[model samples]
Target chain A: MARTFEFHGGVYPPERKQRSQGPVRHAMLPGRVVLHLDQHAGRPAFATVAVGDSVKVGTPIARCDGMISAALHASISGQVTQVDRHTITIDSDGLDAWQRLTPLEWRTASAEERLTRLEHSGVVGLGGAGFPTHIKARVSERQRIDTLVVNAAECEPYITVDDLTLRQYTSDVLEGAQLIASLCGAKQIVVGIEDNKPEAISALRQAMAESQPLSVTVSVIATRYPSGGERQLIKTLLDRDVPDKGLPADIGVLCQNPGTLLAALRSVRDGEPLVERLVTLTGEAIADPGNRWVRIGTPMAALLDEAGLNRAALHQLIEGGPMMGTPLADLEGVVTKTTNCLIAATRKELPPAPPESPCIRCGACEEACPANLLPQQLHWYARAKDDAKLAHYRLFDCIECNACSYVCPSHIPLVADYRHAKTRLRHQQLETAKAEHAKHRFEWRQARLDREEAEKQARRQARLARQSTQQTDSQGASPQADLRSLRIAQTAAKAAVRKAEKNLARAAQQDPQQSHDDLETQLATAKENLQAAEARLAEARSAGEPQETP
Target chain B: MSDAFSIISLLSAVAVLTALGVGFGALLGAVSERFKGDESSLVEQIDTLLPQTQCGQCGYPGCRPYAEAINQGDAINKCPPGGDATITALADLLGRTPEPLDGEAPSEDLVAFIREDECIGCTKCIQACPVDAIIGAAKQMHTVIEDECTGCDLCLEPCPVDCIDMLPRSTPLAQWQPVTYPHQMIASDRRASMEMPHGTHL
Candidate 1:
């Protein structure tokens, strides 16, 4: 038995995963599937198929738009019913056909080839984050990764999809882990499983013994809620703290969920895109509580109904687990790449939170925080909308595990406040960046205008100087020359006025109904110029210079 | 003979004190010249906090001019496009109390739209635009680059045919952010119940 390490504060939530334990069952095909383009964390994928097009299972419906995004494939043979900005709806034809990529020999394939396969297969972190796996694996290019931590903790209560995945396909999971380790040049693999899942641990251990290619070790950690978190698991397995606002790769360690590893394996070895995943359907309101292999884009209501959901007894329908799951207000919501578990909990089973009260200033919340954050202070600052104070307190480090909210004596939703504050802070940062960009553009435009103005002024000065030199050469230094030039300028201004008046008249006659405002303004400016020219000529004449009409 | 010696000693002491005063004054002048703070950089710092709309609602020609005026003890609440946020930022930077906005705050961000068919091709709006967001030639239909438009509304008055319309900016679906936490459930549920074409429940 390998010695394990301890993380910071954590709580022991009841492990209600026993009810969901069984052989994984294949869910019925959904009549219609709604696939969101932005199922992954980064930029949304671009739709490749159009409406009225037919698609077989595993057919590419959307292609990755950027390096951080993942491709999307059809989960069932279907006709594209609608293609919109956010999602693509496909109506199944009940064929359950296939269109798959070419499988690759993971051991013999080059690292680049295996990575490309992973990128094209739409594999993401199935532990609920939905981060594109290829991007995470590509971190090896910048940093030398030494350890690959296989997270099998499944620490959240009522979530047994990972456990069931390990029990059913233990060797496949290990093989996926080894493939990723080789891809990242990692020398050792560490499987971190909480002691609560004895079956999963035994299966993992037996699979490791059967085919031991790389150095593998199983670290059975104590059962604790949220121990499955990436940061927490890494701390327990390797005792390495992922730095503030940094990734696991920064410390030469990469943590991957077991389900995500299996998906990667299926994509490379079986040439199958990530179309289906095992989802845990449990809670007291469910008649048949067990894990089922659900297709992506299946409607939540249909899956719950198939699991014998008692609507009358169901108080709330959570999309993940009790500790971190989001409450589903609408049953029509469809599953995506991140959907892992659906808990149709009864009112008594998961009671509604009591009304919030003023904080008693007790240290219970601080003690329960897994990230060692001061929830009480954070709650106050978040409510006050004090961004500076929240930043100073390292608000971004919060994993939003709801541990503080669970232990709050005042029943305050600390995690909710923190989430709101984080969103606001992020929005503020984006706005500041935009403001800075606009300033730069404005300044650049100003500088260009100034330079153009200076050039024009310089050109006008040179023209004036050249004209004066020509005048000095043509006419001897005499007052009559100045008078003659003034008279010439007056005549030219008079001609300009005549031309402006004639053009304005023509424009008015050409379009009787059109407003001739621009033409009128031009004529008015020309008249003003003629008046100034006449004034200058009169002044020259009064100066006693001979006025010669040219 | 003793009185004559005292007068000579007093004159020598006065000469030494004058030399010391001049020497210390020269050193102090050199130090001040070498370590003088850059005043324009202060103006630059203030300008960064402004929204850079260049709308001239602050009685200045542009954001930089307003930043200069603020550096010279001008009020920090005249920017309507920046609104109270800019005022608060300026106040924080200058260590002064934030004042209420001097002018009516813009209700929402707006971008100018040219009714292409109605445009007379005067190019007045193009010239009036401070950010050069509008692109066109003389006697050619002008259009606003929505992304670069600051929504300053400076071109509205210069448009001779009244073809320019200031409309609320529309956010693309890709840029739309989902509300988090407590309100997320209700907002997403409402969106689903309405059966909006885009059925993303993130």
Candidate 2:
């Protein structure tokens, strides 16, 4: 029985799914693989292996340095030929020359040892972002999580790699999920599968019954555009609205991808690091499009060719699902750990969108938005270049699910508009930050200039006093000159006192309760100013001139 | 005699006041309409949001005229700079927000950087700039008016030399959301396994 959901705005988009669903097939590995450093969203994994070093399949090539990054391994046994700014290429050691063995049996090691091995295996969240699985396990353990959610939603249209994986490797996926649950010390596990795939759900249930943990539950969720979205899936299955900007872990829950769990099980039980993944190759233009087990760092062109697709038929080769995928400008770019699906389509299969017409004030997009955002209003604010207004309408809340664009009768690429507007807003915000930093730099420069000017004046006053004292000694016999020197000293002291008082005044404005030490410093400065001013006044009086005024 | 005198006086006072006030108020509103212009006010505001670049990026003759058409309930987001933001503003003005201008246009902070080495001096980018930001003779390398450059990136398409590259503006630290959103972490973690047997929970 297929599970369906309510309140979802999805079109029965023509599923052109005929190309590659026959049987699981493997692609020929390339002689040289270009592994991009920043394959995932987080911190790019730093390359641990150097050029000229020989690495075997499952050899740790890059190590995770931060909480966000993932570790990388050599997909094939090869010599590292080139590591440059954009990519790292490994020329395969011809025909598996290095040792390639099956994953070790885990029963040989204790649970703690097994866990340690899993951590050292360099396994990350293979489902997509490549977050370190070990880190997540640690989080789950800390949170005292009671349940682990396994996502087999696979909601993105035309992408059935996960569904195919479950069909073939349901037991493996379950085992991976169980291993993760054990590591996290979770009590219950729930695998949420979308209702569209009844066979996968039945296969999962059958695997669970023969399995020991009679407690694992499988729930069929309604199919929706974003039902596959982690937050939405969690909400639908658990009835928990993960607080905006908060993680599932915050709510004592953790969700893992179906593929990631399988990888984790293999890593923990089999002692293997992730080296390859199942990539979905589906699109109307392709001669053959289906799920194929592909090695990481496989060139897209090569993968398409392996899938029996002719490049001439494919007008565009896109990375990921048709709805939210990015168009690959260069097929030379190799697949990374995050490459889940590669869709190859001809223009005729998915025709170019019609020319955009003026909005007739129709509210179709808002009605279609799953996030409950006023997409129409957002578009308006976005069009006006008003970032503030866009923010006010909660533009950041838009998940870019493409449902809005899918429903627009006018054929507007609504999601693209939101993305572009969002990108611009982010860029402007960055500019604002740079401007603020520049402002601070200018202020600091000005303050430094003021300090230097003050210091120069202080030095000049000291030098003048020294010269006057020498003059007084030289003119010791003249009473008038002696009186003049005494008066100059008094005036200088008074002037110093006045300057100190001004400093005190400014300080008082900044802080009401001046410390005794601060007050004393101010007094001292004031005394110096008073003395200097008095000295000049006295000198003027002794010289028979009018006394210097205060 | 006393009762007849009171009634007559009251009736006489009411009749005089009602006649004078009614005649005066009616005369004032008639004078105001004669001075008021018949031009529509809403059309002027919509014209401002149009890029005014007059680059024909919108497939319109000019921006102000496009605004006039939009004021009459045309699609928003025609201007690339205005992009989604403009659509939103127009939506605000017209009291409707719809996905209208979700089409493709270069809407980033991009200014044409002349590749000094590859300049054939075709002066094509200058002709393409709707804002007249590019200044150069037909045979000389052109310079972009940095302040005037809206970064619409219209010049990039027309460059025969392909010298113009729309460099992605650097995201300052403040605006850089941690590239890894939490949901991706959760999603990736849930389905990380590729080889698990069907229906089995880890």
Going through the candidates in order, what fraction of the true interface contacts does each contain? 0.16, 0.01
Clashes of each: 0, 98
lDDT for each residue of candidate 2 in A310-391, tens digit (9 for 90 to 100): 6677766777776666667557767877788887767666555654445666888777776678878887787677777988
Per residue, candidate 1 scores C-alpha lDDT tens digits across A1-550 of 7888888888877788889998899999999999999999888999999999999989999999866789999998989999998899999999999998998989999999999999999999998889999988887887899999998999888899989999999999999999999988888999999998899889888888865579889999999978998899999889899999888888999989989999999999999999999899998999998998899999999998999999999877888888888888768799889999998888788876655568899989889888988889998999899988998888999998888887777777778788778877877776776666556556556645654554454455445545765675424232433777878988997898899899989988765545665566556556666666666565445433322422
Q: Is the docking of candidate 1 incorrect, acceptable, medium or high quality?
A: incorrect
List candidate 1 stretches off by more than 4 Å. A454-550, B1-29, B96-100, B136-141, B171-202
TM-score of every candidate relative to the true structure: 0.82, 0.60
Reference-based lDDT, residue A370, model 2: 66
Is model 2 an incorrect, acceptable, medium or high docking prediction? Answer: incorrect
Q: Which portions of model 2 show Cα errors greater than 4 Å?
A: A1-8, A97-122, A130-132, A141-144, A210-214, A436-550, B1-202
lDDT (Cα, tens digit) per residue for candidate 1, span B53-147 = 88888889889999999999999999998888888888888999999998899899888899998888888987788777898888888899997
